[model samples]
Target chain A: MPKLDTAVVGLDIGGTSTRATVLTLTGQRLGSGRAGGGNPTSHGAERAAVELLTALREALSDFDPARVVAGTIGLAGAGRLLADPAGRAAFDQAWQDAGLRCPYAVHGDALVAYASGTAAPDGTVLIAGTGAITAQVRDLRLDRIADGHGWLLGDAGSGFWLGREAVRRLLADLDAGRTPGTLATAVLTELLGSAEIASRPRATVDATIQAVTRRAPVELARLAPLVVDAATHGEPVATALITEAAAHLAESVGRIRAAGAVTPVVLGGGLLTADTPLAAAVRVEIARQWPDAPLRTAGDGAAAAAWLAARDLPEVTDPAALHARLFPAP
Target chain B: MPKLDTAVVGLDIGGTSTRATVLTLTGQRLGSGRAGGGNPTSHGAERAAVELLTALREALSDFDPARVVAGTIGLAGAGRLLADPAGRAAFDQAWQDAGLRCPYAVHGDALVAYASGTAAPDGTVLIAGTGAITAQVRDLRLDRIADGHGWLLGDAGSGFWLGREAVRRLLADLDAGRTPGTLATAVLTELLGSAEIASRPRATVDATIQAVTRRAPVELARLAPLVVDAATHGEPVATALITEAAAHLAESVGRIRAAGAVTPVVLGGGLLTADTPLAAAVRVEIARQWPDAPLRTAGDGAAAAAWLAARDLPEVTDPAALHARLFPAP
Candidate 1:
């Protein structure tokens, strides 16, 4: 098949920042842009969105609209299409008609990871980042999600969860009047900057405490490896947290398999990219839990979402030629 | 000290039924009565109070008014005492004089379990009835709690959780076109009284479907044993439920122990009574989770609550002494 020139733009929205990229029908990144701020949906549905579109426009300033025929956005915490009409309108309008150029598809970031990573489109993605979400892509639709229930309630096997768990263990060590173990002391010092977390007043301590909940998904995800480091150094508490996180990821993978998904998973995001023991732990757990499942690394999820959007628009290019255009010889 | 002749009453108000017992200073069952109706608090607060008082007065008609000093009533759910002085007055006037009794406390029935089961004045109680709630009694107060987030949300280690889980597993099995496993088939048979739960009409199924959330604590609680039995009989799903339930229970227990509590634990309610393997599994998990903690059994929580109430007010002769006074000997 001849290479397609027309391209689609994909936007990856994270808690702290946003990244945008234009990919050709062959999956090559033509131009990219980045911006900052949490998702507007997390803030007020309306106001946060205005800021996002403004930011998106600024990111796409260099791109020619004629070359960009369609778009897709992989957003954090957006499980599926807005179930409620009002929410859908709000999401659509907030993007300032980013979907106006062509049919815009919005999905949870997990799908982007799967599409980009898995050699075949039918597989799963374990996204253990600043916030954790497991996305299983079966065929072309999003299917069988697990965890990602937010910070106060769930999000069991995530980077934020790991950080919080480390803090909890550290506090316990201090209260028990024992030497803070390697993991506890390291993570606690990282979170509290001292051994005085136990002595500080609740409000004061809480203020000093790191915002483990809202770390920038791509940046704060680096903490997962620190935990892995401590665990590798024989830190029992750190090992347990990482192991447990792996188990949770594995459980979600198992559910996807049980739901009739076959092997081949794409691993993506901050936690998976870290060169640490925890990532190995996750692989071991996944292998043990689903032995037949193969794993692969994923690229920028936004590009995949853009590729998907472009795939549906035959006027833009042949759908099958999207990935090759985006990542050719990259 | 001489045995006192004064008496008090204890009421256990549930969703579908209400039980009131009169105990002589020695914790002897002087008189007992029952009523059918839901908790008044669930109805209009005022209307429920009026009806509740009417029932209380009817029950107390058998007791001499002058002898009743202080009493305690255990209710369902958590909330602060209605803060409005006038509202409290109206509530007291509405429930009749029972609300005016000195130290008359309104608490969740899980407290009844905690008081009834634990040998210590303060300990933890795992209530696995229709709904599940794990309560920690510390400093004579209903201190920390976990689960009981209702059936739709949490309640991980309860019988209701187990039953609902079994149903989900069965449906998943059927959707996969696999013959239902032993555990799934048993649950389907029990829930639908048929070979397939999937075959039932949506509304008919919804109507017949035992929503574990609205279930009587006692009834939903009874499901744990079925799962345990299935596990012992070699059912994978049932065994998994018991194991998962134990893990959840241990997590709750761990949080309590981690929060600087050294109190012993009391396993209470119908779920923990002798003969069920669920109790043993829970105990093993608790032991593994909190190695040094002592665990005990609670027999007849309502009766135990009455006994503890008496123990607190020595002026009311001790329940053991009162039992001797009333019955002459064991």
Candidate 2:
């Protein structure tokens, strides 16, 4: 019989934050911890490892480290980190330093996301947060991907893409000497501040452009929420932009997804997971594209990672029952 | 009667290079000089002034500065520079330092580009070099503009756009596990050396992606010539990209152009001025869009600036004749 006090560790290393969860073998959440971004590609390997350890140690504080039976980490940019020996070593050292004695596996974020939604072994995972990418998972492993090409090259239908389109619409309106719609006005106000826009009506467009171009291009993702808000208020420009973004995301999945495959399709990232207009639009698009495939919204990735760790343990007799317990149907 | 020794000074301030010309009121190209970029928006105002002085001094070496009757400067980012007091002061200081005694007028680069191709005072000018922009000109002044939003926001059919598209095509092929065509292969070879591609067939895609993402985004413009080369060799991908670019350029002009206007349409910048496949495609698209409008390729902007300066002078009676003499119909 499995020890009643036995626990498993799961981590979700994202670009913005690292989340860790400690769960018992029977799917009871024991402790949870969060820290700053721990993705090696965004932060250096050393810093990422340090962050991972911080979150891990915090999560393990309530439960004794010795009682941890298994561990799994779902890391963004996993391929790049695995390819670098120094990065791999840093992560390995981090895992060991966290007092993790049991066997642990590191999987791509896509696979973890797929597992977070369902226990399916084969499926497609589409993510559209700061960047956009779709991956096909086979046997709980990432098989192929499309359009995660970063901001400069691709990332179409992503937050950054949506924000960029909003700015573009404002520019088009300025070029045509037309008054901007609610979305464009909101974007301008957000970027240039209301005072500047009001004080220099003629210079608002130029000021907005300079303000946007002066920052890191990825920061455009911050404007995405404004678009959603505007779309919710029945703003035509925002509505059209959301529809176009949905089409781009659907096309990205279409490029990698095998036609007529009816496996589960998991949607990840804040844009899709949240109950936003963009999420609704994407669901409609996905359903239209794959009417037969069941769509699932990902739950807490760290919890899913812990579940993945618990599923294969010999002590856990019914993995599906535990998954249901961890992530009850909404 | 106009003094035979009277000359006009013209300056073309570009982002990469600045050119200055000295021309007799009779349209004689007396002397010309070139220096580094003098665009105040790219380089700081102080540095831009220095570059302008350098080119002005060189051009004035063969002519007496006091005998220069009028001067015209066509500057990129003219709006931004004019809006800055420091920039205006710097350019004024540079003019004084260069020993130019004649009163000078500053104009936008779009006006100079339109003047370069023809003597017409009203029409449109489309430029596609490092960036893409289209402007309508009325009475030799920039009237309305479209799509000069730089690399991040717009510049849809620009060199940067072309290079980014090339990289995207290569990435797509890599994602699909398919062999890249000539254009994508050439882009990979250029970004990651030929040896790397030959040695690590499996790693080429990742390596190429890393190599690209590590650099400044604007550097992607450097790869545009390869697209032109590939298209010239009958590569389908390159051909398609070129066609798309042409459509975008045409669309930009169409946005600002009046319907059924028989005004002259001028094409400027390296991409359109050179007798390349992209240029030919643009010409075809332009012809198809506005068959009644005369299509003219731009000549040396410095000379066009000199012609503009000389045209309104008391000494020059035949401005059209001087324009023809300076541009020399091809």
TM-score, chain A, candidate 1: 0.78
In candidate 1, position A162 carries an lDDT of: 76
Question: Could you give candidate 1's per-residue lDDT for residues A234-315 as a string of tens digits?
Answer: 7788888888888866765564466434467777767785656667888897776667777776786667777778767656
Q: Which stretches of candidate 2 lie over 4 Å from their true place?
A: A1-3, A35-37, A43-62, A79-100, A195-202, B45-54, B80-99, B195-202
CA lDDT of A96 in candidate 2?
A: 86
Question: What lDDT is reached at residue A248 by model 1?
Answer: 69
Q: Per-residue lDDT for B69-186 in model 2, tens only?
A: 8999998888788889998999899998988887888888888989999998899999999899999999888887888888899898899999999998888777666678899888
Best candidate (score: DockQ): 2
lDDT measured at residue B243 in model 1 versus the true structure, 0 to 100: 82
Q: Lowest-lDDT window of 10 residues in candidate 2 chain B?
A: B195-204
